[model samples]
Target: MSKKTEFQALDLISAYSEKKKNPSHLELNQIFPNPTQPRLIGREDTADLVPSMERLGLIEPILVRKDKGKYLIVAGERRYRAAIKLGWKEIPAIVTDANEDVCYEMSLAENEKRKNLNPWEVGKAIQYLRKEKRKTAEEVSELLGYSGRYVKQLSSIARLDQKSVMELMISGKPLSVKNLEELLKRKENRGGETISPRPGSGSGRISINLSKLNGRVRDNFLKELGLLKKKYGINE
Candidate 1:
């Protein structure tokens, strides 16, 4: 289909712009999480999409709203990031009349339509919604089409330190959610202590569980993993 025709068919923007009858394109200044959004744009994905936009122009316009004179992107963060990376001066965008709540819901819906999130990412997103958006775990569960227990699981995954999470994501290895849960349980058992091994617990068999290690421990684990791969000449 033609690009303009495709843009016209995107009912989300058209429905919102129908009243104004004169929606204008705007630059993306702010990006906000869509509560109902599902898709996530990783670095590699951005690289691919940016080149595509440079070649074809943006087939779909992003949705946004005016916020204190700056445009806040309610949907299409991936597209925005791609445009910025491609050095596009102006992007086709549809101004939406959707309220904050509606925008958030639409964004979340858009994101969720993609493939499922990894356990760790899901955990982070759910926790962000609960903490930043002030939504209850139950509320997030309902909105995200996840069970309350599942939402809690995601929150638990988010609690792991950043270094550990990134290592898992980059390793391209499948992590055992059960193992992670056990690790979380162990960390909790330490009475809210940090994710690191306790100091001076010397020779006490520090009971290292593969799951709960984050930050430095996670880094160390990756290093050790590399050594093991070299030592054993393992290839997968």
Candidate 2:
């Protein structure tokens, strides 16, 4: 995260105090995830949170909106999940009347500062705001107060294959921006096909387009590909 982003996130955190005019308790089972939430709650990421929440209680109240008869979570999902795992019947929440658009804005604001989103998640979030909210990449960039290039990079990451994404999310591999760039390059160079498994297949088949090459040439190419994968830390 950039310094500017850090400051913006702090600004939103401070805004929480200003808008926290109504703090009350709601049944844990009554709260549902916002339909437009972009953040993915992974078990690995939230495992330690349960223990911390048990020891400290909830430091900040979750932001929620009343929908139908149930409450919809606007932000603080990690904390909310922690509270649930701790067997809390009721949890502290700040009820707000913000509409869906405003709720999504607040969710993004909180996520930007938290710095917990992986690159794929960041890309997907950017894409989600563009399509769901009908905002352009430039507009989302402005909303984030980030550069257009950064927005484009995330757009690229969002296009990665589901298999690659699943591996990245689960493997505990460090995906630097440079690694993301290389992945994008490989994707683009293939013109449409990727090394990932084909969709809708029970067995994930890695399709290599070697029909045009002879056996000797294909053998040499495979040798070089193995070396490249190791250099890039791409697990087979």
Best-performing candidate as measured by lDDT: 2
* TM-score list, all predictions: 0.59, 0.71
**lDDT digits (tens) for residues 1-236 of candidate 1:** 10111211134433664534454666544444343443432523576687788899887777776666567776677788788788766777777767776566565554444433456665666676777789987677666667665666667767776566556557775654554554566655743223223456333433456777778988987788677557544453
Stretches of candidate 1 off by over 4 Å are: 1-23, 28-45, 175-236
How many residue pairs clash (N, CA or C atoms closer than 3 angstroms) in each of the candidate models, in the order given?
15, 0
Tens-digit per-residue lDDT, 86-113, candidate 2 = 8899988988787777777777777767
Clash-forming residue pairs, model 2? none
Question: All models: lDDT?
Answer: 0.60, 0.72
TM-score of 2: 0.71
Segments of candidate 2 deviating more than 4 angstroms: 1-3, 7-13, 19-22, 41-45, 169-172, 188-236
